[model samples]
Target: MTLRRAWVAVAIAAVLAFPWAAGSYVNYVTCLALTYSLVTLSLNWVTGYAGQITLGQGGFFAVGAYLTAAAVVHAGWPLPAAILLSAVATGALGLLLGVPALRLQGHYLALATLFFSLAVPEAIMALPSLTGGANGINVPPSTTFFGLHLSNLRDAYYVLIALVTLVVLVDRTMLRSKLGRAFLAIRDSETAAASVGIPIEVYKVTAFTASGVIAGLAGGLYGSIAGYLNPATFDLWLSIYFFAALIVGGLGNVYGAVIGGILVVALPQLFSQAQNLANILYGAILVVVLLTLPGGVADWPRLSRAVRWLWHPR
Candidate 1:
């Protein structure tokens, strides 16, 4: 295999082996990292791939999580069934929202999604009967997977790994297909893409719907792992965090999503000594990277080339 392919294989192997290689704390952290990576990858479908900037991802995530929790607790549905329903429902809502909202571009669309993100939780809160009000709802015991129950940290880590692997595989496959090409074309130029026989509106809505499904899946998986659901957990800041992860990782690449996702989730834990200091440090790092390396970590090859030229004085 080529160097890139070799690196990809190594990364996958390491991710798969993390539960066995790490302690309880590390395994927990890895699980969180995998979850964030899944969300980031989903965000990339619209933000990175389709060139749509949405600030409502947290809303969709919350919807999925709450739906899963509600279905299991109130409706007495099975875990897998609840999760599937959440994905479908959220994806449908996303398509409905995208159909009308996709007409706008840049900041307008962003503002529209922002409204959705900010309003969703409050709306849930207002409906005391359905959403358990502001107190949030508790998740029930998790279901068994195969023959193993995911109650322990080690078992939970394995479940996250499996889900993340499936998501990443789907992302890779989609990016190599016609739909992926349509996304790229739309991102490049809508007019140009439309002129070439691409159905711009259909594809845009589809991308948003796909992004919703990914977010839903990630959210359901998260709810299962945490065994709890809270409106605050899916607040607007969460969307900002995911967006920051994408910007830091390299928006258009899957590897970048994974790397960025891990860093975004790990940074707060790693620098929890002083909250303000951590934010300052994190913001500084982001600014420095954006100014010096616009393409994020995934563009390391170009960065390396620049370093080599500077050293050689060529």
Candidate 2:
């Protein structure tokens, strides 16, 4: 086999065996990272490939979480069923939101999405009966199906691994498809894409819908793993962090989304004991990465080549 394929196989094997040796906390964080990766990847779908800026990811995240939680707690739906329903609902919401987005550009679109982020929490507050308001809502992770219980973090981790693998494949496939070309075209030059008969409006809406569906799925996974939902959890900073992580990990690529998604969550935890030190270190790291790689962590390939060139001088 080729070197790249062999490396990939080894990486997959290591990931599969990770939880076996890792502590509970480590496994839990990895699971959270996987969930956040979904959010970042979905954000990449709309903002990265489609060139549509969004500040409402947290809002859509809340929608997915709440819908899943409500279905499980109020409507007596199974966890899997609730997640499926939530995805569909969020996709519809994306389509509705996209209509207005068709008229917006740059900061105007950003503001509209920002408004959404601001509005979601308040709407939850208004519905204290269902949402539990500030207290949020909880659903124990003791979900059962076919006599098998999924109460362990390891179970969740494995499931996340599977989901991440599937999503990654889908991302790669879509990036090679006509739809992907259309989005990239629109991103580079909308007028040119339109001149070539590409439906800008339809594609824009499709991007939103696809992003929403993926974000909804992420929220569903998060809700299940977290066993709780709070408006405070889906705050404006959460939306902001999606962008931050995307930039840090790299943009317009799936691997970057995963790297950024995982790091954005994992980094704070790694330095949880020292807030000030963590802040300083994070700033330093960001500066170093920006100056050196510029393409974020996923740009290590270029970094490696530069290192090699320095040693060889040929």
Clashes within 3 Å, all models in order? 0, 0
lDDT of 2: 0.83
lDDT by residue (tens digit), candidate 1, 200-269? 8898899889889988877776777777767777778888778888888888877678777888778888
Worst 10 residues of 1 by lDDT: 305-314
Model 2: how far is 5 from its true place, Å?
5.2
Native-to-model Cα distance after best TM-score fit, residue 104 in candidate 1, in Å? 0.9
